[model samples]
Target: MSITVEKFVEEGRDPFSLEVVAGHEYLGRIIKEAALNRPGLALAGFFQHFAHLRVQVLGLAENAYLKSLTPDERGQRLHRLYQKKIPCVVLTRNRQPSSEILECAEAFKVPILKTPMITNRFINLATLLMENLTAPLVRYQGTMLEIMGIGVLMEGQAGIGKSETALALIERGHSLVSDDLTVLRKDSTGAIVGYADDMTRYHMEIRGLGIIHVPSLFGVASMRREMHLDLVVRLERFDPKKEYDRTGLNSETISILGADVPLLTIPVAAGRDIAHVVEVAALNQKLKQLGHDAAKELDEKLVRALERKRRM
Candidate 1:
């Protein structure tokens, strides 16, 4: 996106006093030029040389102060600003302008808008408008890796094979997002998503391997800037006593970015293909999302069989 300039009369508030000719010209230019703009788009051009330059427009009191300034002072102020050919002058408060100010507006073709809002509110509204109109690129952290069909968040006590699994997944035709920490942001609809930070996009740290670049080892599609986290697979050493959930009957979960993501426990046992298992688990989760819960269906069948036998 391209950033568009907006003229705010007193913070783009309602009930603005605009020079009819100037407003017509400005709005006409905007309608002809600005195309396919996002909603709430705005960019402001503030004219500093206004009536009573010393008058600070702060919050609600701005209007009262402008009202106190003498009419001659205000007229000269508007004239000077109009001569500068600035976009618009924001008259603070709902204070109506004097006749001299209005006449100068009609003659010089400069808009005079009266706003009841403070500077902060005006600035915020302006910022929102600009962003919506432009759709600028946003900075983010963490790498997004597609393991099988699952969006696995590979996080652990550093040194864990996060990048390694990502590399393996990439070799298996999966994609890599970020390598280390991923910064997550919620969209307007509240969907949490991930993206990679530029500094550590393709970089990863393996103890003996040191820092390695992922893109160098794998092709372009192998790396992604960011992805939505659908699963969290924390790799830890295998514990013999820990009875791992061999069955997916009881789906486990972990909270990330305020959403409960399905979780899986993969024990890193020697000779076992941990990465492969994680990949399969992700695939299984995708299936579940499609309304095919394999474990639940099997368990339901077993329960019915037991009930039939008991009745017989």
Candidate 2:
């Protein structure tokens, strides 16, 4: 997903009336402070760790190290730093930009944001700015399980063993995607793909087994970073009154990101091989894509038989 680019400003303030600067993000927000200005909250520490290319700290304050420079010397120093060509520079304490720095900023298209926030408070917000700016792209929640060479998304209501099914699949040679929640993204060509978040990449929770690492137990082939979401199999308790599609004649699909994906509503009964059914469904969908429809062929054969009997 593409983000709307806007000018950098001080955090906790309105975005309008701010000077235009060079910055790009899916969600634009202003940073309140810089590492030099805000020393307590460790905003600089956070920025140092996140390593996001999008954030730029502006106008640093005067420390003993920086105060050594005279006005002209400071201007030269600012120019040298600006030459690095970061996303933007934040000017703390609402200080005015030097003519040389301003000219260099304008020339390089680097935005200079001014804010009254002291350094410590500014760093706190800068961390937030980086955190919220990047929206989740092609990621999933929880743990994904791999089984039978298929990326099965074990989905069910809360506590219905979605993660457990995924864990089982992983033990049986499938891969994990996400556990409880999965973030879905659609590409430009209308393909929906899913991925595991960096934090929750290969972790899963089983009832008695506690937290087990899928990749460690199953090896590299048992894990996948992303999958195309070829099928959606929803598991539900068996309803006696409901008329399930025993013949597999109907074509049911699930819509995600403006595209229809093959869907299977498998009922969970005692001793039912849900994983096997899902694998077969995925294989069948592949066959259908190659123009082999078993149900259609059977229907055609039955129709021909009926016509022959009528003629006889």
Best by lDDT: 2
**What is the TM-score of each predicted model, taking all chains together?**
0.56, 0.58
Residue 274 of model 2, lDDT score:
67
Give the number of the best model, judged by TM-score: 2
Q: Write the per-residue lDDT of candidate 1 for residues 60-114, one digit (tens) a residue.
A: 4433443566776656654554464444444444455667656766686545444
Error of 1 at 44 (Å): 19
Off by over 4 Å in 2: 1-104, 107-152
Query: For residues 157-218, what per-residue lDDT tens digits would candidate 2 score against the true structure?
Result: 66655666665566666666666666676644566667766686677667788877877887
Residue 311's C-alpha lDDT in candidate 2? 100
Q: Model 2 lDDT vs. the true structure?
A: 0.57
* Candidate 1, residue 198: lDDT: 59
